[model samples]
Target: MKILIVSQFYYPENFVIYKIAETLQKFGHDVHVLTGRPNYGYGYILPEYKKIKEEEINGVRVHRVDLPARKRGRLSIIFNYLGFWYNSRKWVRKTKLKFDVVYSFQLSPVTILSAGNLYKKKHHVKHICHCVDLWPESVLVTNAVRKKSLTYKILYSWSKKLYRACDEILIGSPSYKEYFATTLQIMDKNIVFVPQPSLVENSRKIKTQNLGEGFNILYCGNIGTIQMIEMIPEAMKLVKNSLVKFHIIGMGPMSKKLVNKITELKLEDKVIYHGPLPSPKAAPYFKGANALFVSLKNEGIVGKTIPNKLVMSMAFTKPILAMLEGDGKRILTESKGGIFARQDVKFLARAIEKIAATPTSELKKLGELNQIYYAKHFSLETITRKIEKHLR
Candidate 1:
């Protein structure tokens, strides 16, 4: 099958779609990506992508469309969203590439799937939406608009229409099903729960680096607001074990504030910041750690999310220290793979303390349990097979 995967963000933006495309291509499908220029977290488009257009990445081919940089402000974000929606439509219409199916890697804006929907409608092909985010519900989480507001009402209606047009919808988390059935009034759609596969490539031998012995706890991914990185220093303050150390392996908007909190809490010696490193490069740190920390805010729709970081941690055989609620916490509990906390600073401190006190062999056993569960549910091979079945 010649499949075209449409997404607003791809490649350098750190989206799972990049992995999906590559995997699909490796599965003997001609996979192509229609995505906006690489400009996500950094706000501005990277210099290398400025004028470059269509090209082959690995074996999968990629098509590009330009969009406004989602710089700092709310207005800029709106422009970026609308820009992709508008430009993707133009690109789809002009491209001569015909595909057997259209896979929509939907995230953030529900309309990111619009290009796939458009192509599906025009070519009379199948459109499979991989929905990772809910629209109006997301607005509630961000406080972007009130439920009764005109903006929310409009997005709510539009989201329903777009989703209904799809042949099937894939939910990244099982918690999303209720939202689809209730809020979107989409009970009849072929909505299947497909967990986000670990973006970490665990195929290669993990070369563990020494993270300075005394019980190193690892965290990888964005150090942004929702990540609850600020609680680390606060939690460490309560933790009785002085030998336990934290190693954060990513950077984001909250970097400065997180640093200030670390200093204020006088945890300079306990917390180690490695700025940001690529996933493969950061694997050693993940492999070397005594435990992996997964934290998220315990508020509204966001809490219901099964973060990629949580699944990614399970890819490596490491005992997890999960601090969140809903789907992610449920996964940890169900697998009996790691210790859980309910987004409380004191609880987080206690979880860390527990890991510090546990024997290294016990921690490795917990990691093996996580790996067993991940193999059954969240592994790339498991997910790709599910996707390929649908694509066929």
Candidate 2:
């Protein structure tokens, strides 16, 4: 099968598409990516990639189109999206190549899937829309837009059209199935629950580092509004254990605010903020930590979402300290991986203390259980095979 993956973010930008494309190629499918030049995180295109370029990554083809260079701001982000949407639409219309199937990695600005839907109709092929974030609802919860606004209504209507056009819809969490079925009136038969695959390589060994003497709890990935990172410092103030250290290993819009809160709370000694690190560089922090942290703001929309960091932590055999409800908490409870706390300072403090008081042997056993569960459910091979079944 010749498959074309349409995604706004791809290789060299730290997304699952890189590994998914590689896995499809390994399974004897001809995989190609239709993506924009590397511009995420850095907010500018890389030096090597030209406005339009084609490259082969591990036998899979990648076609990158030009994207507008912009800083991190509302207007800048909108311009960037417009640039990709326009360029990708033009390229798709002009290209003579055909695909057996089209896969859309729906992240944000769901309009990107329009290009894939177009190609699916033109080529008469199967189209699969894999939604990582629920639109309109996510935007509303993050206060990006008001539910009564015209923009919000437009987004909602556009998303419904996209959902209806696809041959199959793959949601990252079971909770999302309920959202689409109940709210959007989409049929449950067309929606499949397929969680995101772990990025951690099975054979890769972490060069563990000595992270001093204490219960090091690591929180990785994006530190954004949805993360509710300020709660970490607030909870730290309530924790009595002086040795329980909170290590944050990422950067985002809330980075400065989190740093300020740490200082204000006089938690400078208890919390350490290590700026963003590449996935490989971040491994030691995960491996060295006694437990990993995952949280989201207590909102109805947030409950339906699962952070990719949680799945990666499980692959590393790190017990999770989750302050999340719904699908995320369900994963932790079902795997017997770690303890959960309500999204409150007191409960979070108690949860941390519980982990701190537990014996190292018991923590190791919990981590081992998480590892076994990850292998059975969230491993790359397992997820890839599940997706393959749908592709057939």
Candidate 3:
């Protein structure tokens, strides 16, 4: 099968689309990627990727479209989205190559999938939209736009059209099925639950890092408002044990605020910020940790979502210390992977203390169970096969 992946973010940006494309290629499918140039994180186009509009990397042919450099303001964001959307639509219309299936990675903004939708309509091919984030609801929760505003109404109507236009929809969270069915009036059978696959290989082992003699808890992902990473430092202050250390390894908008909070609380030693590390370098920190931490803000939309870090943490076989609810909590509880608490400083502190008191042997058993569950449900091979069946 010849598959074309339409995503705003892709390889060299450290997204799961790279893994999915590679796995598809390994499964004897011809995979092609259409994505924006590397301008994630700081938004500056990397030196190596500059001046090139298209290139082949690792046997996969990549078609890149120019996009505005990302910035913090709303104007900058809109420019980036509009630039990619316009260029990608133009490219898709002009390109002569045909595909058996058009897979759209609808991460956020949801408008990025418009190019794939056009192609699917023109070719009458199977179109699968993998929704990593729920739109309009996410925007509303983040206060990006008000629900009653005209902009929100337009976006809501646009989202409904996009979902209905697709031949099938792959939702990252199981909870989204009901939401789409009731809210968007989409059929439940057309919406399938396909959790994000873990990028780390189960066979890859990292040497544990020695960071003093304490129970190391690691949180390694985006440190943004949605992540609710501030809970870590606040919870650390309430923890009674002196040996528990929290290591945060990611960068986002809240990075400065988190740093200031750490200093304000005088938790320099108890809580350490390692900035952002590449996946290879970040693996050892996760491997060495006694437990992995994940959190989502107390928002209704956030509860129904599962962050990719949760699945990645399970791949390491480390007991999770999640401050989340809904699908995330359900996955943790069903896997017996680790303990969870609501988004409260006191509850998180108590949950940490409970994990601290549990015997290392018991924690090991929990980690093992998490690995078993992850292999069965969230492994790349399993997920790729499931996606393949749908593509065919």
Candidate 4:
């Protein structure tokens, strides 16, 4: 099968769609990615990638479209989205490339999939959309937008059309499937639950750094209100276990705020911030830690959705410490990988101490359970085979 994978972000700048495209190629499909210049990690587009529009990296052919570099402010983010929506969609229409299907890895802003929708209409081929984030509901997650407002209502209607245009809609979790069914009104045989595969391999290693002496709880990813990462400091202050240390990696708007809270409560030694590090650089921290931490703001549909980090964390063979609700909590519960807590500080503090006090042997058992569960449910082979069957 010839497949054109559409995504705003791809290789060079870490995203799971690149791995997905590679897997499809391994399955004997001709996979070509239509993406933008690699510039997501840094605020602006990297100088080297700015001039290169297209190239083949690791056997997969990539076609790059020009997009505004993702700058820091909210207005910059909006421009980045609008830029991709216009440029990628236009590129698809004018390109000579042909394929049996067009698969879009929709991370956010439903408008990105509009490019795939146009190709499907012209070619009469299947358009399979992998919805990493739902539309208006996603917009509502930050709490800045209101459903009653005309702007939100317009976006809601637009989101539905783009989704319905797809021949198949791949939902990240069961809860999202419900949202599409009850809210977007597009629930049918076309919609299926196909969780995204993890990019982390079982054997990649990075240089180990100082992650504290005792049982360290490592949290990696965006540091912001949406992630509820601030809870870490508040929870640590309440934690009586001195052995339970928290190591934070990654940066966001709330980085300073998180530091301030830690200082205010005098948790400087307990909660150590290492700033932002690339995945390869952060690998050692994950290796040195006794357990991994994951969290999400329990707000609306976005809260119920399963985060990719949860599935990715399982591949490391480490116990998980998740503070989330809905599908993520249920999956971790079923895996018996680690402990769970609500967004509250006291509960989270207790949960952290509970894991710290568990015997070494018990912790090892939990990590092994996580590995087993990940292999069974969210492994690359399991998901790839399912995707192959659908591509037909």
lDDT tens per residue, model 2, 260-312: 99999888889999989888788888888999998877677566477788889
The runs of at least 3 residues in candidate 2 whose Cα sits more than 4 Å from the true structure, single-residue gaps closed, are none
Show the lowest summed lDDT stretch of 10 residues, model 3: 201-210
How many residue pairs clash (N, CA or C atoms closer than 3 angstroms) in each of the candidate models, in the order given?
0, 0, 0, 0
Instruction: Write down the lDDT of every candidate, Cα atoms only.
Output: 0.86, 0.86, 0.86, 0.87
Q: What digit string (tens of lDDT, one per residue) describes model 3 on residues 62-178?
A: 999988977778888889888888999999999999999999988886888899899998899988998888876878877789989999999999988887888889989988887
Candidate 4: segments with Cα more than 4 A from true spot: 204-207
List the candidate numbers ranked by TM-score, top first.
2, 4, 3, 1
Off by over 4 Å in 1: 203-206, 252-254
- What overall lDDT, based on C-alpha atoms, would model 1 receive against the true structure? 0.86
lDDT of 4 by residue, 224-304 (tens): 777888989999988988888999999987899998999999988999999999887887888788999999888777888
Clashes of 4: 0
Candidate 2 Cα lDDT to native: 0.86
Clashing pairs in 3: none
lDDT for 148 in candidate 1 is 87
